[model samples]
Target: MRKQMIDSVSKVIAENENTSLFLVDIGVWGFRDVLKNYSERAINCGIFEDGMISIAAGMSLSGITPFIYGISPFILGRAYDQLKLDFCYQKLAGNFITTGAAYDFSKLGYSHYCPEDIELARTMPGLEFIAAGTPKEFEILFNSTWNDGNPTYYRLSNYCNKFDAKVAFGKAAVIKKGSKGVVIAVSTMLDSVIEACGDEDVTILYYTTLVPFDGITLRENLVNEKILLCEPHFEGALLPAIIDSVKDCAVKIKCVGVPRKINRNYGTKIEKDICFGLIDKDIRLEIRKFFNN
Candidate 1:
């Protein structure tokens, strides 16, 4: 997936003279060698995330399209003020691509854990968020929205769904149709959601774009008043959208995601998943409980 982004962005930089790439120490390794050919446009900005956002905003003001790449927590969480004031508040356009979705770096502890990235991003008005579940999805979303002149957040994960469904900007794909309830899976949670819902009478919706929540398709495919939201990030991230979309109807929503609490443990992501009840068996149990109600 990193290769796909690097290759695609390299092509964009080579062709478009107004485009530039900024790396925040994390992407320096993979991007350093490729950026050698375009030394003037691409640069490693070290670990100054807040400063980097300001630089990208300035570049945007100068008519240069800046693509900033870094780890999830540092890029989004650490420099959030810069992102809000420089890019979002100023209405400037840039692409903020992040690696390490949620707890992908669980072994490294809470410094690298960022389950609230989506929640923070959605607060900034007009910002688009895309959680790419596969390399193909990232390539497609990047190509479609990179030059759209909106501040877009692309969350890349070390763990991705095995299959690549057709994805688009602000659109949800219906993976299955049923009459029991609706299961909306976001990014890396799709595979687990599918495995948990095997043969269940539920409609599955694969959601890649988080910010511009595709509620239209969700409303149109309502099989029941029950909704199960499977998100890779913090729980209730999509609750507002869910309620707004089904405003005319009375709906019941059950969310399975990272708990809204501080996690002090350090281990693999799977261990965290077990602790948070995000595993397939636990998800299945939750689904059954939801249905029984």
Candidate 2:
């Protein structure tokens, strides 16, 4: 997915002269060569995440569309004030493409993890959030919104789902239809949610673009009152949207996602998932509890 993002960045740079790429010395591995080829266009902004965001805001003001790429935790967590003030506060337009979704860098410890990015994004008004679960989806979403002149956040996950719903901006893909209940899978959690669901008579709604959530579709497909929301970020980050979508109905909503707390373990991302009870078996148990109760 990083490769796809780099390729997309290259394509956008080759096509548009006003576009620029900013990195805080993080994406050097995949983007080193590209940076060299377009040194003037792509810059390695060192480890100064807040300064990078301020610079991006300036560039945006000067008719340049900056695509800032960096680790999720630092870019968002470290420079949140810059993001909220420089970008969203000023209504400045730019693209924030981040890696290390949730616990993707689990072995690197808590400093590398960012489970609250979505919640932070939700606080910043006019900032659109798109969490791509696959290389193809990243390509599509990035191409479609790179130059939209809106403060957009693109989350590239290390993990991906096997299926592609040909996702679009601000739209949810209905993967399966059933009368039992509804399981809303956000970003990369679709595969596990599907696997955990097994052969249950339930509807699965896949979400790639989450900010401008397709509540209309969700409202139309509330086959049953039971709803299970599975995401890769902090639990209940997308809950308000669900509640708004089903405002008229008494829906039983359950969330399966990363807990909003510190993770001190070091291992693989899968191990982190196991620790959080976000694996298939645990999610299945949650699903059963949501339905049976």
* Tens-place lDDT digits, model 2, residues 23-85: 888778778776887889889878899988999999999999999999998888898898899
TM-score of each: 0.97, 0.97
Q: What are the candidates' C-alpha RMSDs?
A: 1.1, 1.2
Q: On a 0 to 100 scale, what is the lDDT of residue 253 in model 1?
A: 88
What lDDT would each prediction earn against the true structure?
Answer: 0.89, 0.89
Residue-by-residue lDDT tens digits, candidate 1, 1-293:
77788877878888899999998877676776657988898998788999889989999999999999998899889989988989888888899988888999998888888899998998888889999889999999999999999899999898888999889988999999999999999999988999999889999999999889999999999877999999899998889988989999998889999998888898888899899988899999988898766
- Sequence-dependent TM-score of model 2: 0.97
Which residue pairs in model 1 clash with each other? Answer: none
